[model samples]
Target: MFKTHFHSFAIALLLALPVAVSAQDQKPEAPYNAQLIVRQPEIGQGSPSFVPSPQVRGMKALSDGKVYLVSTDNKQLLAYQGNRLAWKADVVGSCPTVVGPRKISKVLLGPKTILVTVGERTFAEVDTATGKVKVADGQKG
Candidate 1:
């Protein structure tokens, strides 16, 4: 009777040992960052105003403090100087009008030109000097 009772108690203890070890090894939940804000302002008298939407896709700010936005949807490029939109021009060729894949891949600013690339195709000198677009072969289009 003594041996039977001891064996049963030992078996119970062995079964509970793994559960206790796992509980001790469990990790606590991670804390979230408090700096990010996503909620839109509620409709009220003194709420923060939103900026007017522009017809552009990927927006990039230049070193000259000019904001450049590409409208893949409209097949055009735009430039914003200060709070006012300064320029808008259509991109050459049959490219995706929406700002996504198959659109203008990259934009580079030179002393007097802006270089734009779409996939493997490249446009070397888009003259920004007189707000004119010149193709790579040195012809105005």
Candidate 2:
């Protein structure tokens, strides 16, 4: 009886996985120019993989027509140049114990960089042109 109940519970949990994942990605309506930065992966039947979709959380529009989009689904920061994806980085966790998406509080603009706050003291400056992380505190460049 225990084995039978375990099997049923496992099946139920497996069935609910897809629904929970999709619901976690549901987000509010995007901006008028949201189309310019959205990414949709083509997933065929029976592929059985996470499609790396963005849970569009926040976006910043630059004066030069560039766009920066932050995704919590995959912990990524994507840079776009006029509706085309320039580059994307998997900013999962900058430092141990400070996992991304949750640690990140604010995204700011500094000259030609997008500053992603890691904590009260640390931040990562993503180059708007190259999409590379350049730490400001003499650590990385």
In terms of lDDT, which candidate is strongest? Answer: 2
Prediction 1 TM-score vs. true? 0.42
Judged by TM-score, which candidate is best?
2
Which stretch of 10 consecutive residues in model 2 shows the poorest summed lDDT? 44-53
lDDT per residue (tens digit) for residues 1-141 in model 1 = 999999999999999999999999986532211121112223342322112234223333333455455553534556655445677666544333323344455565554566665434534345553445566432222
Candidate 1 Cα misplacement greater than 4 A, ranges: 1-63, 94-102, 137-141
Residue lDDT tens for model 2, 1-141: 999999999999999999999999987553324743433223332221122234444444534555676665535677766546788865445444343344555566544777766544456677878878766331232
Q: What shift in Å separates residue 17 of candidate 2 from its native position after superposition?
A: 50
Candidate 2 Cα outliers beyond 4 Å, as residue runs: 1-56, 94-103, 119-121, 136-141
Model 2, residue 60: distance off in Å is 4.2
- After best superposition, candidate 1 residue 3: deviation in angstroms? 99
For model 2 the local lDDT of residue 7 reads 100
lDDT of each: 0.48, 0.56
Cα shift from native, residue 33, model 1 (Å): 24
